[model samples]
Target: MKLLFSLTSLFLLICSTALAYDNEPNGFKGLKWGTSIEEFKNVYPNATLQKQQPGEYNPANIITYIVPINESKLSGITITSPFRYSFYNNKLESVLVTFTGKDNYETLNKQKILLNRMSMIYGEINESSGNNIDEFIPGLSTSYYNFNYCWKGTTTTINLNGSYKEPNLSSYLSISISSVEIRKQWLSKVKPIDKTEWSKIRKNIISEYRSDW
Candidate 1:
């Protein structure tokens, strides 16, 4: 009995160590952000910035930023939340943005702070769009749009999108899970997003991004 108990404890210790290592975030090596147009072009050798046409509402047209990761991949960030100041006003608005590249999952995960600000902007849009209070709650109305990142080797494609509802001053937001696919061909080799290990990575990314705010 003593020997059996020792073996069990040893197994548990190994399991715990494996879990901790798996949960740890894989530190990224080649990611950089550019705060200005010239800096962006310097990092992204082929990037170009263009001004918005008169009377056009191109949110990204104002600022130019770039991120270069890996040999043949690039990422960009454009500050598009027009209702940035209404975060404290309890308003509603709409948000639209895009990300592209292979390792963008980490970069996008780091963008949750921006997303929170965009949510505030969405609150403003809902109010200006004349959404009736009876029809929808100000803080409750939110939409999430995302295109799945392609795996290294797979023909299958995954698309993810959802809408969330969180009433004003509420801590918990209700997310409408529109679609989730985890199959052998595509996302099987990649880590599952809902898993606990991925959650830890996500939490760390958000904490780092919001450190200033």
Candidate 2:
């Protein structure tokens, strides 16, 4: 299940599509895609550098910064999550906002709330869903499930993704926003990735759970 989930996420990272939707989100906060990292720091002085790590699909390392503004309203629902901005080649390439709850039910409920809001705003441009159930032991079962809704604009793509695992009852929910157009530009200028960098640049999604949990 872990291997399958990772592969699917990797494919989606490379296959981000542009759409004609006018209401889709194209940037993070008020910053536009491809904004310089220095300028980003100027606009967000309180943002702290998380790491300068290899991006999932880029040859060089990408820098990540985390800000304090964590609560956001999805239409009427209030969601609290850690938000990170990532830059590749000194330009903003992606933003990730994630929320994970202690238990499955609470996380799933929040996922539904956010999904409803996304549907209202983005109109559900795409859907990706799959699951695997395994009877690991006698009278015991293990399962992994994934469901994601996507929307795209002229330059960006957004995905509201949810994943649940049985036995552990752990859940992960995220709002992943990427500059699909800028990513393409970056891809054009970078060197071809070798085996070592390819392994180093594996997708590193940092998911933060609720503190109250």
Q: Which candidate has the highest lDDT of all?
A: 2
Relative to the unseen true structure, what is the C-alpha lDDT of residue 193 in candidate 2, on a scale of 0 to 100? 58
Give me the runs in candidate 2 sitting further than 4 Å from their true place: 1-12, 52-60, 76-78, 131-141, 188-213
lDDT of 2 by residue, 1-213 (tens): 233234344544554665646476658789898899889989988889874322334344567798775566555555555577888878898887766655666666777778777777777566455542121221133676676777766678887776776654456667778888777776677676566765654433222122211
Structural similarity to truth (TM-score) of each candidate = 0.22, 0.72
User: What is the overall TM-score of model 1 with all chains considered together?
Assistant: 0.22
What would you estimate as the lDDT of candidate 1?
Answer: 0.24
Local distance difference test values of all predictions, in order? 0.24, 0.64
User: What tens digits encode model 1's per-residue C-alpha lDDT throughout 1-213?
Assistant: 112112221221111110111111111122111123343344456543333222222221223222322332112233221111000012111111223212223323423433344344322211111122224333444432221211111211111111112322211111111011112222233333345754554455445433322
Kindly provide the TM-score of model 2 when superposed on the true structure, using C-alpha atoms. Answer: 0.72
Q: Give me the runs in candidate 1 sitting further than 4 Å from their true place.
A: 1-45, 48-135, 139-188, 191-194, 211-213
Error of 2 at 191 (Å): 8.4
